[model samples]
Target chain A: MNDSTQTAVQHRDYAGAKLGMWLFLFTEILLFGGLFLVYSVYRSMYPEDFHEAAAGLSVVLGTVNTVILLTSSLTMALAISALQRGNTRQSVLLQGATIVLGLVFLVNKYFEWSGHIHEGIFPNAPELLARSHGQVQFYGLYYVMTGLHGLHVVAGLALIGIMLSLTIRQRITREDNGKLENAGLYWHLVDLIWIYLFPLFYLIT
Target chain B: MNEQDNHIVTTKTFAAVWIALLMLTAITVSVAKMHLGAFSAFTAIAIASAKAGLVLWYFMHLKYEKRLLKFLLLVPILTLAVIIGLTFVDVWYR
Candidate 1:
C-alpha cells in the first residue's frame, strides 16, 4: 500500500465509533423495554395490587438513589467536557468522582435489597407468593428490572474506571477522546433507565 | 463529525441541566403524594418521560449529534411504542 493510503487507513473515525455505541445502546433500551412491557401489562391487569406492592418500596430511598445517579451523570459529562478543553487534571478528578458516585449508588442498592430480603419480600418467597397474583408479578418484575439495572451500573462503573486510568495515562487525550465519550454515553444511558424505573416502580403509589 | 467532537459544552450548561433534573424529580415526588387516583400513573410516567428526554438530549449529547442519528434513534423507540400500544389495546378490549 502507498504511504498516504496507509496513513488514511490508520485514521480514527470518531463519529462512526459513537454511532456504533448508540446502536448498542438502542438494543440495551429494548432489552429493558421488554421488562417494562411486562410490568405495564401486569400493572394494568391488577392496578390495585401493583399500587399496594409498590408502596412497600421506600420512595425516600429510591429518591436518594435517583439523585445519586443523576449527579454521577453530571460528573461524567463534565469529565468529557474537561478532556475536550485540554484540562487533563480536572478530567481525571471528575472521572474519579463519577466512579465514586457509582459505587455509592451500588452501596445504597445493597442496603435496599438486604432490607427487602430481611422482610422476606423477594421473588418466589412465601410472603410474596401469599399476596395477590398481581403483587407476585409486581415483585418479580421489580427484582428483575432493578437487578438488571444495577448490573448495568456496575458495567458503567468499570467502563468509567478504565476511562479514568486512560485519562491519567494520557491515552485518552483531547485529540482522541472518543473512548471517554463513549463511556460517558453508556453512563448516561444507565441514568436514563433509572429515571423511568424510579417513577414506574417507586412513585406510582 | 470530527469538528463536532471539538464542541465543548460549558460546565455551566451541565449544572443547569442537573438542577433542572433535580427539580423535576422533586416535582414528581410531590405529585405522587397527592391522591390523583388513576391519573397518578399517567402523571408519573409523563414526568419521568420528561426527565428521560433531558438526560438523552443533554447528558448523552444527542442534541449535539447529527439529525441522522436522532432519526435512527427513533426507530427502536417507535417500535417499542407500537408494541406497547398494540398489546394494551388487546388487553383493554378483552
Candidate 2:
C-alpha cells in the first residue's frame, strides 16, 4: 500500500520528484507521530495536569497561526495551478505570498513563545503556584512539538524562495516543474501538521 | 495530476479559495470563543479537515489526478487509522 505519487517511477525526474516528496512526508509523519504517541500516553497518564497546562497556552495566537497557515495553503494551491498553465510568473508570485505568510506565522510564534516564557511558564519554572504545578512537562511537550514544527516552517520558506528563484530564471517550466510542485507538497505537509497540532495542542480539554 | 488534460484553473478559482480561507479563518476563530462541550474540539477539527480537503482537491490537483494516486493517498491514512486503533487498544486497558 505504498503506492503514493512516487509509483517506482524511473527514466524521468517526475517520479523521482514525487518519490522524494513522499519520503520526506513519511519522515515528517514519523517525527510528529512520535510526539503524538508521547502526548497521548502522557495525557492519559495525567489528564488533569495536562488540561491545566494546556489551558495556559494562548488560543488567540494559535488561531492567528492557523489562519496564516490556511492562507498559505490556499496560495500554494494557486501556485500549482499557475505552474500547470505555464504561468511561471504568477506561480512565483503566489509562492512568494506563501513564504511571506509563513514568515509572519513564525514571527507571531516567536512573540507568543516569548510571552509564555516571560510569564515564567517555562517547563522548568511555571509562575503560577497552584495545584497545576506538575503540569510543566506538558508545557515541555508543547514547546517541543510546536518548536519542531516551527523549524519545518522556516525550512519550507527557504525551499519556496529557492523555487521562486528557479522559476524567475525560466529554469522551471511547465513540463518539468515537478520540483516546485513537490516543494509545494512539502509546504502542504507542514500545513497538515499544524492542522492536527492546532486541535491537539490548543483544543484539549 | 491533470497531466495534459488542461485542467488549468482560472484566477477566479484562486480568488474563491482566498475568500474561503478568510471565511474559514473567521469561523475557526469565532468558534474558539464558544462553549460547545465536546463539540468545540470537533468543530475546530471539522473545519481544519475541510480546509485540508480543499487544498488536496484543488491545490494538489487530486480532482484531475489519476486514480492510482487517489488510492495511494488512502494507504497512508488507512495505515494511520490502524495504528491509532492499536494504540487505543493498548492505552484503554492501561
Candidate 3:
C-alpha cells in the first residue's frame, strides 16, 4: 500500500462512528416509543384492567432483572474504560461479566414467563382470551414490549462477545477503541430502554 | 491519537452513578406501592426519566461528546415529544 493509503487506513474517526451509532439509537428509541404511545392510549382507555393485569406480573422478578441489567450496563462502561486504559485482560473480564449478567437476566425472564404461562396468562391463551378486552390488551402489550427488549439484550450479548474476542486478539486496543465505545453505546441504549419499560409496565400501577 | 485528550471516566464516577441509579430504582418501586391516585404514574415516569438521563449523559458519554452530536441527540427527543403530545391530544378528546 502507498504511504497515503496506509495512513488513511490507519486513521479512525471516533466521533463520526459514535454519531452514526447515536443516529441508529434514535431509530431504536422511536421504535420503542411508538409502542409506548400505543400503551398510553390503551392504558388511558382501560386503566383498571391494566392495573389488574399488571398486578399478575411478579414485582420481585421484575425488580431483580432491573438490577441485573443496570449492573451489566455499569460493567459495560467499565469494560470500555479498561480498554481505553490498555488493560485488555481486565476489559475482557468486565465484558465477560456483562455477558453472564445478561444471561442471568434472560433466565429470570424465562422463569417469570413460565410462571405466567403456567397460569394460562399468555397472550391468545384461552384463559387470557376469556378476560375483559382491557385485560387482554394489557397482556398483549406486556408481552410484545418486554419480548422486544429481551431481544435487544440478546443482541447486546452478541456484540459484547465479539468485543471480548477482538480484545483478546489485540485487534481492539487503546489506540483504536472506537468499536468498543460504540458497543458500549449500544449496550447503554438497551439499558436506557429498559429503564423506562420497567416503570411503564411494572411500576405504573 | 492523543490519549490524554480522551476523557477517561474514573471508577469512582461510574460507581456513584450506579449507586444513584439503584437508589432511584428502589424509590420508584416503593412509591408504586403507595395509593397516590393519578400522581403515582407521573412520579414513576419522572423517576424513570431521571435514570435514563443519567445513563445517557454519563454511561453513554454524551456529556463528553461534541455539540453536533448533542444537538443530534436532542432532535429525536423533541420529535418524540411532539408526536406523543399530539397523540395525547387525540386520545384525550376521544
Cα deviation at A101, candidate 2, in Å, is 1.3
- Candidate 2 lDDT by residue in tens digits, A32-128: 8778777777776776787667787888788788888978987887887788788888888898999999999999999989998888776666364
Model 1 earns a TM-score of 0.96
DockQ of each: 0.65, 0.35, 0.63
Q: Identify the runs in model 1 with alpha carbons over 4 angstroms from their true place.
A: A1-10
Instruction: Score chain A of model 3 by TM-score against the reference chain A.
Output: 0.94
Q: Which candidate has the highest lDDT of all? A: 1
What are the Cα lDDT values of the candidates?
A: 0.92, 0.77, 0.90
Model 3, position A154: C-alpha lDDT score:
92
Best candidate (score: DockQ)? 1
Residue A94 CA displacement from its true place in model 2, Å: 2.3
True contacts kept of 2: 0.38
The TM-score of predicted model 3 comes to 0.96
Tens digit of lDDT per residue, candidate 1, span A1-205? 2343433434788879999999999999999999999999999889999989988999999999999999999999999999888899999999999999999999999999999999999988998888899989988999999999999999999999888888888889987899999999999999999999999999876
lDDT of 3 by residue, B1-94 (tens): 4354579999899999999999999999999998686899899889999999999999999888778888898888898899999999988887
lDDT of 1 by residue, B7-41 (tens): 68899999999999999999999999997988988
Real A-B contacts recovered, model 1: 0.81
